[model samples]
Target: MIHILGKIFSIISIISLIFAIFTGNLSQLAGAMLDGASKAVTLTLALVGTMGFWSGVMCVLQDIGVCRLLAKVIAPILKFIFPENCKKGIATDEIAANISANMLGLGNAATPIGIQAMKALSKANGDDGTASDDMITFVVMNTCAVSLMPTTLIALRRAAGSANPFSILIPVWICSVVCAAVAVFFAKAFALFSHAGYKMKNARDSAPPKTRESKAGTE
Candidate 1:
């Protein structure tokens, strides 16, 4: 997938360069590229401080046992969502940390925690090549996680000179909740279908084969 994406991007870049040359806009394109690079650097610098602050907050929360408290609060929900993993008490702590970080709008902090959770889940699954139901559910939840405080987004808005950076809070809450529900619904639906198919296949495979005499008798 990475290779395919790289090839697609290369093709697009080549096509754009050709178009720019044909239209005699090569200099303009070059200037635009430089301006975009400058903006990217500026944005990265602006986000650096916000990311650092959130990272520190995550550490402080952990040190103060807030993470554990939050984990305990959400334990029931996690158990419901990750029955298999929760049954064996696997990846629970990592999962809780990831969720907590996401809720706090610490995406950068959540990413590593999410990766650790995935690794724990994969290990518990015996390192199987295929993703398990729990992994799928986790991915869905992580991707569409609810953010009670979208600090990163607010920082970006502030950097962009928004009159009211926090104006998006309500909309973000609504959108995140809706997206998470929809994603979880689909993930669970697919898992249920997969399990049903597997059970049917197993039953068919375990059934006795019909003998020639039985076939004749039936006929």
Candidate 2:
């Protein structure tokens, strides 16, 4: 459905563009587009370099001990984040580590690790089981990440030949921080709800043989 909607939107945009051109509005549209492009070039250039550079750095980090170090740093938080998996299953560990790398703006580095993590989680949970809150949290957490450096934006800036390439640093930081906070809050909230339901069920099940209700038949 999303793909179809996207196609429809694209077709509409193309038709609009064609109509504008036929009606002698193409020059104005072109000028407006060029202005927007010019403004974005700086970010584009910065982004390209940062993404590639950080990606390589992350790969090297994995090859070395940096990724492990990061995993270690985040382990405590991960434990709290995934209360159900206290013992660090291979799948859980991989998922946490990959997510940590992605948080550092290393999506490329996270790919194989993420894949490995998913397979492990699936195997652990079984084929019939759906994704647990931990799994969903990991996925959501990755999407609205809080990046320390706006490498991609910087690359875009550089590509666009911005005189002041680092101008968007603060904006990126603020945006990322806000987005990450919201994502994490939602993830934890959902996890808490799920955990609470499990606890309620367990507590009810374990409540000492059900007192008067079960004894009524015997009486």
Candidate 3:
């Protein structure tokens, strides 16, 4: 689906550029492209410093084992939610660090840890890289993660010249909470539904077949 969308957008861009050239608006197109590129570069530069600072902070937390302490606090809840590996347990330290980065709204910092967690989850699945229930649950949690600080959003707002950059903090928290709740609810619901279906199928497969004698006796 993503590939298809990318192709569609690429074709649209090509067609639009062709149309602009035919209409003698090539100079306008060039100017617009240059302006967009400049803005993108400026935004990237502005974000780089903030991202680096947060990443370093998270790294320091990990080195100092603060992440492990946080992991210990949340381990029971994590184990409960992901029962597949309840016995073995997931890598709590990595997950906790990832969650911490997310809560701080350091998405760039969170991404590496999130990737590590995904790899750990994939190994726990014991499959050919196919996503398991725990993996799906983690994905849902990460997608709808609550951003308590939302530094990135605040930065964007500041760049846009908002009078109060952090004004949306409360709103962001509310939305994140609602989204995460719904995400977890649906993920669990689907997991239960699939498990029930598998059990029903297994029971049917294991049931004994009626013999001819039994059928005749019944008749």
177: Cα error in model 2, Å: 4.6
lDDT of 2 by residue, 1-219 (tens): 999999997997698799997999988877877787776775565566677777777677678877678778777776766666657554667866786777666776788888787777666666457886656776787777767666666766677688988988888879986887688789889878876776566557756456435444423
What are the candidates' C-alpha RMSDs? Answer: 6.3, 7.2, 7.0
- Candidate 2 stretches greater than 4 Å from native: 1-9, 18-24, 27-59, 88-90, 161-163, 170-178, 191-219
The Cα local distance difference test for each model comes to 0.83, 0.72, 0.76
Evaluate residue 147 in candidate 1 and report its C-alpha lDDT on the 0 to 100 scale: 85
Candidate no. 2 TM-score? 0.63
Q: Per-residue lDDT for 14-80 in model 3, tens only?
A: 9979999899998898898889889998998777776677667766766787655655666676776
Worst 10 residues of 3 by lDDT: 210-219
lDDT of 1 by residue, 168-217 (tens): 99999999988887888899999989977765665566554544334345
| Better structure of 1 and 3 per lDDT | 1
Q: Which candidate has the highest lDDT of all?
A: 1
Candidate 1: which stretches are off by over 4 Å?
1-12, 18-27, 105-116, 123-126, 196-219
Clashes of 2: 20
Q: How far in Å is the alpha carbon of 203 misplaced in model 2?
A: 18
lDDT of 1 at 17: 99
